[model samples]
Target chain A: MTLTSDRVEVAADPRQQYEQAMAERWSDGVPLLPATDDAVEAILAASPYPADHALCVLPPRNGVATVELIAINAAMAGVEPAAFGVVLAALEAMSEPEWNAFGLTTTTSSVFPMLVVNGACRDELGIDYRASCMGGAAGRGSMTIGRAVALCLRNIGGQRAGETTKSVFGQPARFGFCFGEWEERSPWPALSVRRGFRADQNVVTVHGGKGTFPLADIHNDDPRDLLYLIAKSLAFPLANPYLGNPENGEVIVAFNPMWAERFGRAFPDVEDLQRYLRAHACQPIDLWPAANAAMLADRGRVDPEGRVHLFERPDQFVPMVCGGLGSLHAIALPSFGESQMQSKAILSKS
Target chain B: MRTHGVYMRPHQSYDAGMSDPATVWVRRPTAAPGGDESAPAFRLDRAVSGLTIGVREDRAWRSWQLIGDIWSEYLRRDGAETITVETGAQVGQPGSDDRKQIDELAAVVDAAVVGLGTCGSCTTFTIKDAVALEEQERPVVAVVCEEFLVHGQNVATHLGHRDLKILVLPYPLEARPDDELRAIADEYYPRMLELLGVAS
Candidate 1:
């Protein structure tokens, strides 16, 4: 029997009990908060989803997760149950077929799903997209929410090492990497609105980013120059465009509200900027060796012309506006080869 | 494997959330007692006789392209019939939405080699592709850079994959001199074949 979160009793000797359960497998390597039944129940009280509702059947280990199970993870996360429910919604979005967890979990890529929070929830959920928001600082809601998802993936999805599947050096994001778009501070609408979601409703957009790529253009204030610099940065040889078709992957540009507004004013609309980015985010075919070219050509993923745009179809280039008001900095979260950005509304029913 | 299951940080069960302890599942093998009759019976040599090695590209293509050619060369040296090579833009791309290509490839070939081709993030994807082939009950191995080996293995274990294996390469996907590239191929080919459980 366990106490509810409202009634959580400090476990009698929590430390010794934790030690006997399992060995540590994470950095900072602290004992995680137990996702007890009471904790889950408290968390679930904030969400509309049923306690027993199956959220996802994670691959490799195939850990079947229920809404109540997610709440347990959320309880451990230490965020308000309502905030935790938002995390749950994000996970639901990422589990879509296009996100391809079946192929992703077992693959050798270090890339994992990175959740980007946007809209009114940015403040409500307490995501820190201001300065130093990409991965450090250990904020509870910012870091733990991400970690809880990773825990859900590991404990629930069954992604334990050498047991179900294989991947090399799974990223810190595997532990949980999430942040909100600094919409109020941004110059334009949040990435959600750019993707067609309204500004009022809170939404979570899950991107299959292999890793976070920070773009610093201390020199270019000219919108075109800054964008051009960003375009060049996206064309890095190590980027997915080098190996896969641009149409299949994504390049998420996290702009400050100020910059977003400026870009919106400059480009006026999201598609125009996406078109400009899509046109500019190309690389010469010569950058790769003949063998790679042959492989790409064989698939028709690239054109016979040396020029290769990031996307095969114009829509593959995704433009999202987020982050703090401070200008001169942007974040580009690149996609993992075949995954898609999945989205769902934060359920208000609860 | 990144670490033995014994080292699992004592975590509370997902919904249980008891700080007291977790109802952790112990690690056990699935091998039957009949002298391993369930083990795959086909020899590595028999499997790759005319395999069509599919190179599934995610973000980094040069290495995968190189790997495909290397595998083709190695197989030819063993007198196997020509191995047809193919590549894709990977998942999330609209280019090849037939996400089941690994199964299709396994049906068409004796064995397959897919590469996240590089990095910890990308390698996980390659491992997924290899596991897909394994799901079809086909022989496959995922190749990744050395730095990501531990990460890849964790992902493999998390997914409950027993058969998936990773082939390691050095970091920095820049061009190595021809001889160096050859040496890498020479070192990893035998290791990969061994991992595929096909070294005869």
Candidate 2:
């Protein structure tokens, strides 16, 4: 198929091409593969949409993302032909209005899109879901798929560090973070299944995660007690959820396989576990200083018993099973408060 | 080099004694620049008397709330009916409600002042709320801090409301005493009116 994007001539040598990319402000401070015609065409062959179809308009600069443009960036990120569909799905999910791409892209907060995948493709694509799945997994799908999207944001969306995006203390995930759920190890239904996708469909859920907040415990064996601590830990006074409307965002709590098994024995239904966590995820109003207390009281966040709950609903505390088999740890992907997580099923050329 | 799973092939072959260095063709990844056309800006060129005015305040900024309250009092004293709406959320039910309120306020009010763009995302929403008023052909002024003036302008430009009127307040408006904020409110109140095209 004929490509419509503008083509520029660059040096043949990899080292020279790297310099050219740097000079053009196309590199994310890392060397990227050349997006040659062959490379871009390979990625385009895997897309469900035509070359000129506009997938979405990304914010910060409000760039129109067409399938061809996406493929070029994906090729630059070295995305395999088979994995191009994941990148497309992620962009589609983030474009959903509830995801609040406009606000998240321009916020001073350190929030960025964190990709969570589910379904059968996780193993085939090497989307790591266990043993340092959040990082250090060196999984191809996790690494390249995430980077492709990040590159799209930079090149297609025009998301510059201090200029377009006002993110203060931008986190490492800005470089790209993608991981999957260990569906087999989880006692609960797969995240995509719970979100209403089929078990066989490859799905991507994008969360506007500020950063990963780790929670660990080895003392309590009782599921309820350990869950209580996890809930309390999630309700940290300065969390974004506590700063704004409780109905706005969800905090993703990723549990290790061992903890998931134990918790499953205590509460078979995931909804029941979520309800229990929500009930306890609150802080005494007295925890904050006078000024903060006044704000919470003004917002009507303080209940009659003088407690400030993190969120209004139980489902806001989303639980997923992933990470190493070793117990004593869970990770909380805190929300941006103004954005809701969105999920889209990956669609490939049939 | 192998990148994750994709194996990238070399762009071109190099000869042992090539007279000229070989080059390869690649697509430029950046999007085309946006259009220069901007939406029309409205103005009230009349006296404030007998006109209903709106003041949009952010729940996150106490300083802006104090200023908004003072401005509301000033507007009422000048014989204009004032409606004040405080918004905090940018998405979900709260955000939807907030935007609905802005639209409703835009429908009734002759002119409005939308504010508290002291932070990044807030500035974007501040411009957005002001644009809603402008969309109704009503005079509106978006208020932002000195630090975020450019950012507010950029958001306005990107939203195709490049000519939207903006009023700049002092930076670090937070943590200041009420009296200091009151003085600031007193100082910028007339400028806010001017930006709204209020008659002298």
Candidate 3:
């Protein structure tokens, strides 16, 4: 239900009252929508959820999310309803039992849900599939959709750090993080498809991730060498969520499509990259101190020979091709280690 | 190093102060009922029986361990059939093997109780395990430490669940002596019972 429809607090004309939205901290150092009633309503109209429909129930102080509430935040993020639908779908997908919102949200770990969009909608919506898609100048999908979720988290969930939230120096992505899997450009099958979605499905993959750990390497040419380096990058001492075992985590290595073609030339099959990444995402025993190493061994995180991989399955690398055709870089979106991605098809409507 | 005192300390300005009440509701001092007595509760009907309980043999961050202890304690004392899940190995930290242990534990138990376990890495996997259990249609309540309640709540809401409760426990996963533990348990257990709607 709409929870509270007690008049939306009548105000003067939104256009006249509004100035540059930059001054409000209601932004990620960017402009924002004022969340005017009209604007919010227009967005809400596009969704299948009634304005009163309860979309979610958030915690530590579980707040119920209604459609209008989501719209208000979406309006604040300057999102169109079409994109808003994607946000709704993404949020809806994350609500799945497998996404484990309860623990991810409550833990002291700096992990939050990162939305990875895939399928035909990625291109149709102009989601940046490569080259600074996660950062730098923004794409509407990356900026608005991501920002909308952050706003929803803030406005709806009431996640104020040091208050209900105990995050120590929370990461930047908490503000908003959205990027598309560059499937057409990647060397491998689309992430959504690999996860069992159809070719045409509009899918949103919800990954509980701490934040984006930039994996930029320009020196290597061969995709294998580059992937090997990328795997090593994911296996870094701090990169592994558990210092004891490499296998507890999942890392998504986002390859720009240009490199995907090349990587495919070297290893055409998607499984080849998964195998390569799995083999290479290893850390030397020296990376951990003896005591820590012992702890890892004791926990069985370390192998007998002391080899620790990021996960038992090489496919945990979660390879996806996304990004512009830029050949030199790949962004590694590290898993929060607790929340694996929960994918759901994006309904064009609500 | 301690943030609790820092957060609880009064700010530079105090416009108004209130008289101390005869009682404050929340049981754990971790949330500092003195700070703000009580919040809403995530309750259950009657009592849950036939459950296993245990936390990982891992050092947890914040109060994640508190949750595990409380969960196990709750299930144990609730007069239910309870067992604790085990990795059959010391599996903590981030790794596939740990996931396997969690998977195994989840399989072994009627349901599972996983927490962020304090560290960022383990928290992620804890979430993964909880979700996995849900896939098996097992009733799971993933505990979120005091701080992460909202984020966890938002996640739960987004996932479209009335179950998969995110239990809120205090942080600074240190031990209180047995008497204090019992006292602490005495303090909140009634409220816990009240919330869960159990006539304990």
Question: What are the lDDT scores of the predictions, listed in order?
Answer: 0.63, 0.90, 0.61
Instruction: After superposing candidate 3 on the true structure, give the runs of residues whose Cα lies further than 4 Å from its correct spot.
Output: A1-4, A10-31, A243-249, B1-200
- Among the numbered candidates, top lDDT falls to 2
- Per-residue lDDT tens digits of candidate 1, residues B59-160? 345655665577667877765644344445345434354346555676776666777545433555566667666666666777777666776665555545
- Tens digits of lDDT, candidate 2, A1-350: 99988878777889988987887888998999999999999899888999999999987778899999999999998889889899999999999999999898888999999999998888888899999999899999999999999998888888888777888889999989999999998999998998999998999999999999999998889999999999999999999988899998999999999999999999899999999989999999999999899989988999888899999999998999999988999999988899999999998899
What TM-score would each prediction reach against the true structure?
A: 0.70, 0.95, 0.67
What docking grade does candidate 2 earn?
Answer: acceptable
Candidate 1, superposed: residue stretches over 4 Å from native: A1-28, A102-110, A129-140, A158-175, A184-189, A196-199, A218-220, A284-306, B1-85, B93-200
Order by lDDT, highest first: 2, 1, 3
**lDDT tens digits, residue span A53-81, model 3:** 77776544445667777777787777887
Cand 2, B chain, TM: 0.87
Candidate 2 local distance difference test against the native: 0.90
Per-residue lDDT for A143-177 in model 1, tens only? Answer: 87787777666656656644333555667677788
